[model samples]
Target: MLTPPEKPVHWNVDDVVVTEPDVIRRAIGAAAIGNITEWYDFGVYAYFEPTIKKVFFSGLGDTVGTVATFGLFAVAFLVRPFGGMFFGPLADRIGRNKVLAITMIMMAGGTFVIGCIPSRASIGIGAPLLLLVARLLQGFSTGGEYGNAMTFIAEYAPDRKRGFLGSWLEFGTFTGYLLGAVLVTVADAVLTEHQLLTWGWRIPFFVALPLGLVGVYLRSKLADTPAYAALEKESEKREKDKAGKDIRTLLRIWPFLLVCMGLVIVWNVTNYMLTSYMPTYVSDTVPNAQGGGVSSTTSQVLQIIVMAVALCTIPFLGRLSDRVGRKPIAWTGVGLLIVLAFPMVLLIQAGSVIGVFLGLLLMGLALICFSSTMPSTLPALFPTEVRGAGLSVSFNVAVSLFAGTTSVAVGGLVGLTGDLNWPAYYLIAAGIVGAVALWFLQEPNGRRMWGSAPAAGSQDEAREVVEHQDREAVPA
Candidate 1:
């Protein structure tokens, strides 16, 4: 266990011991791997939609097959809120390490099932139904995976360097996304079209089984957060009272809740609409030509490359935030996306593969600003007691409201307007929401890790209520 600080002192990176680095490093590594596996499993559905439809929707026309497969992909995003709710307080109540392990196991199991599932030819509708179920499981697992991973890294980090440390979790997500894209590109190059749809796609899904086992093992060795440590201490002190406290206490702080919701919308819109939806947008617009100016495969390969480069740069930028502060880099990231995301789409419309690459590269860089800062900054908004629950509720509500529907909404908008750039404006609106939230958010510089507030449990907020009631009845 982490020993208490010499005083009730706030943390700073410079003060971290040589041993604490190892702890944070280990946590970051696990967090990164979880993201990598999560996206590796999720992104494949986008890149391999052609293959998946071929296997499962064989008799359907090309247009319908593509639609159904994309629909399934969208469904996974829809399940994120439930996953966040299930995993969030589970981690808060039980332990982060235990919940992390359980989540990875669930994901690995889901991926393994996806790998083993039979197609329409063999089992007909059951195949697609089962596939949707597996995707939902994966989606739900991911919901909790990210929030918890970010929370783990943020709580472990020294306050001074929190931005740098927390951003690694997002860096992990992008890295994982790139890894999935690369795997698809490489697997396509290696296998014939006949072989890939038949079996090669399964290879990627199954790969997670072993990787997830390793993730669980690594997480098993991790210690609980200092915030949780203090919560456990407080819980023990107040053993006589065992009352769950979440929504009522959270709603009392409505301003912070609104900010959190807006932030989530921005985060997910840029994430899904830009990263997940881009490949499809390119497939629809850029023709696969004789010279390969802009094909789906080529676009995916470029996306993989862009994501890889962006993921690498994210850590450096995140570390920069540690030096300068989170908001500057973060708002700049959102602002860049707001300014460039639309123009980048128009560049693609101008008809060049180079333009496509250039567009995504700019958007990816801009998206990283928010992605990197969020892991550290969002968690700092609340004290530790209800950190997991508050984040899950706000994040899920925002995502369900904005994110889960973003791809579907964008696709519908495109069909209606005959213009892909319509989605770009949507991205800008999301960024503006984030910028607004940042205006009110506090930077938790030098804040004590524990005992600052009743973030984990209700005792602190609950006691406040009792005091208020007593004062109102007696004297007011």
Candidate 2:
């Protein structure tokens, strides 16, 4: 029986007094846990694509089986938009915590189930079928996870530091990838290649269970953001109010959604390129004559190093965005990638250790632009009511069309054109799309969200409205 405040509460973090830095720390940490688990699972599948192809799709022959496995991987992305459509409105209606909790469970369960599945040698065609089902479940849940988590973090952030705080979410994502790389690298070291194909590949999948539980616990202990809580209070007052907005009205903001889609295209392409496909590309395509194209083990380690380098810079760019504004910092990253991605591919093709390291390092830095600012930028595109759904739909649709299929597309393009630099052309094209979209977007840095202000009340009353945020800071 909460009453609506006389006026809508401004969702700015400054309005809520924070006596402890831990409040912000805990909030950011809680939001990031799910992201870590989500990306860990994705990274495992992508980084281990070679093993996965050998294990599940062996019936198809070497090259075609690898291609088929990637196709199945892309299938998960196809389901992501549906997950967003189903879960995003529910999150906007229910609460971010509840949605996050559900998504983590689904993601963890799907990943663990993949580990438990019988190998193709034992199950015949059923192995890959079961694997595909598991992936779809994981992908579906992930659709809800990213938007809800990003919006949850952004809403909790102070205006001045939203970009910095949001950057941590991507940090979790990269850390997941890093951890996945570590697991594969360790497996490669401990197990012979046969053992790796037989059992080692499943180890990373099994890790998702415990990781997901931690994510669930972190999200469950938290209170909803003051902004979402405010929305709930108002929705209760207007009993006839619904969580699902008309699709027509949402579509009217097509330009905004398109801009988000374009940015996602840029982000996902760069992300999958450097983090997921780069290792495989370098290992498979680098010239052996020049001491290029290291073994799979070395490739995994190299990717870990590159991911580590990129991850370290994310926090800095996130903070920088807060000062210079989101657009400029984001554009700088995209611009650099567009110009350098092609050349970086050339270096990888050169087959020298120095060239490989320099190419990946440069590409990693370029990716940080989108990675650091994206959490702050995407959520700012819509007001609170439709924010979750808007981002979920737009981002997933773009990612599915571009990022999800990037590895497969690159493989095909290379086979078709016999050019190792096919990825460069793809990345550059995505960058152009991003630049065009950025032009149409207004910078939203440090701006008030939802056009909300303190309810018609005294300053003391507004302060009271946000007191729950501090109260919820008590750790579970």
Candidate 3:
């Protein structure tokens, strides 16, 4: 049997129901803490770039050590697909909550172990390798964190507030990154060179123990998404092997698969280019950036201010999406980034503190537009059963190619082209692609979910359940 083409549903904004504040709060918090740790974990290496180079990866001279450690830092992003694959299906098979809760432990443990790991002077090559292993673990955990949190929050959120609610995860992510930046800055002021090289580096990792614990506790208290629980509750009424009739069934819808993957590529390319690459781009171009080269203190302070500003605006942007819909917000942000790309690059490269801050504010503010909506926007393409697998597979694959590999590629580009504007051009290109993708895209803001839009709190009363009756319907 031929499967029908899925049509986009048009909505009058009035049709959407905004979720209650309490539900939104809990969902937002649940998503936030995990992300806090994820970025915080990554930033650990970035913030301590010099200390890491000096103490952790010995035997290299100044420039060589600095370059080598940053290389290793960039290397961590390359392994995200591994984490996504492991955790994505685990969420599908077991449940999103259980899988999300488990990763917190994995992340915390990896960080703590890194804190305790011996320095390179003591253990030679094994020490840096150990740090690499810890990084990979953190990378893996972080890979799973975003997808699961997105799916989880979207599932629980009311249709209208999907954008607003989704913003919380990104808010937490940046906030956490800022926290890591701040903490490392604190250690810089308080700790001596010897203490820092020997033990000060460990504080950030050690801090993860408590933060991850808090994340674990909050996740536990969260109500299993009513949607997922409703599925299990009703599964009791259905015949057996309905489990066989899972979300993997959607892969047969090739067009949907293509759209999801392509859109994710847009998100990753622009995002990683901005977040992961900018610091290095600044350090390399503006002299006095790496080690004493970049003001670790100034860079971090600027980041905190920039991200804090971004965080404050996210909810409003998200709420605005509830009124105007998602595509507009996404495209608007992308377009602004495209427009501002050149100016942002020039300002950051100017080497003046004021110019750098202004540039970052532009970049950070542009990012907020996407952060407000991407978490809510992406996962609507998949049904609940394979929400994990479908979202994980497409996103991981896109990220593996775009986000994970972006930093190094941009780094190499900067090294070769000798113009950080190469990265700016790249961002503009990505923004243009994203902006076009949004213009022609469907808006799912007020509609039912993937297979069918279920009633807000009513499973059986799902007003629409457009199953892809075709046996091969696995890609929708």
Best by TM-score: 2
Measured against the true structure, the TM-scores of the candidates, in listed sequence, are 0.85, 0.89, 0.85
Candidate-wise lDDT, in order: 0.70, 0.78, 0.70
Location of the lowest summed lDDT over 10 successive residues in candidate 3:
464-473
Better of 2 and 3 by lDDT: 2
Q: In lDDT terms, which candidate is top?
A: 2
Rate residue 156 of model 2 by lDDT: 69
Judge candidate 2 against the unseen true structure and give its global Cα lDDT, from 0 to 1. 0.78
Error of 3 at 228 (Å): 5.7
| lDDT by residue for model 2 (1-476), tens | 11111233434435543322455677788889988998898788877887888888886875587578778878899999999988877777666677888998999899899999988998899999999999899889999999888988777676557789899999999999888888978887889888898788999999999999998887766654454456457534433475345366478777778888989998888888887677767886444324446677776777888888878989999999989998898788778778888788888777667778888888888789898998988887776667778888898889888888888888767766667778889889988988987887767665544433322123453455455433322111
Per-residue accuracy of model 1 over 114-188 as CA lDDT, tens digit each: 989998899999999999999898878877877777777766666556677777887777766766677777888
| Evaluation by TM-score, superior candidate among 2 and 3 | 2
- Cα deviation in Å at residue 196, candidate 1? 1.5
| Candidate order by decreasing lDDT | 2, 3, 1
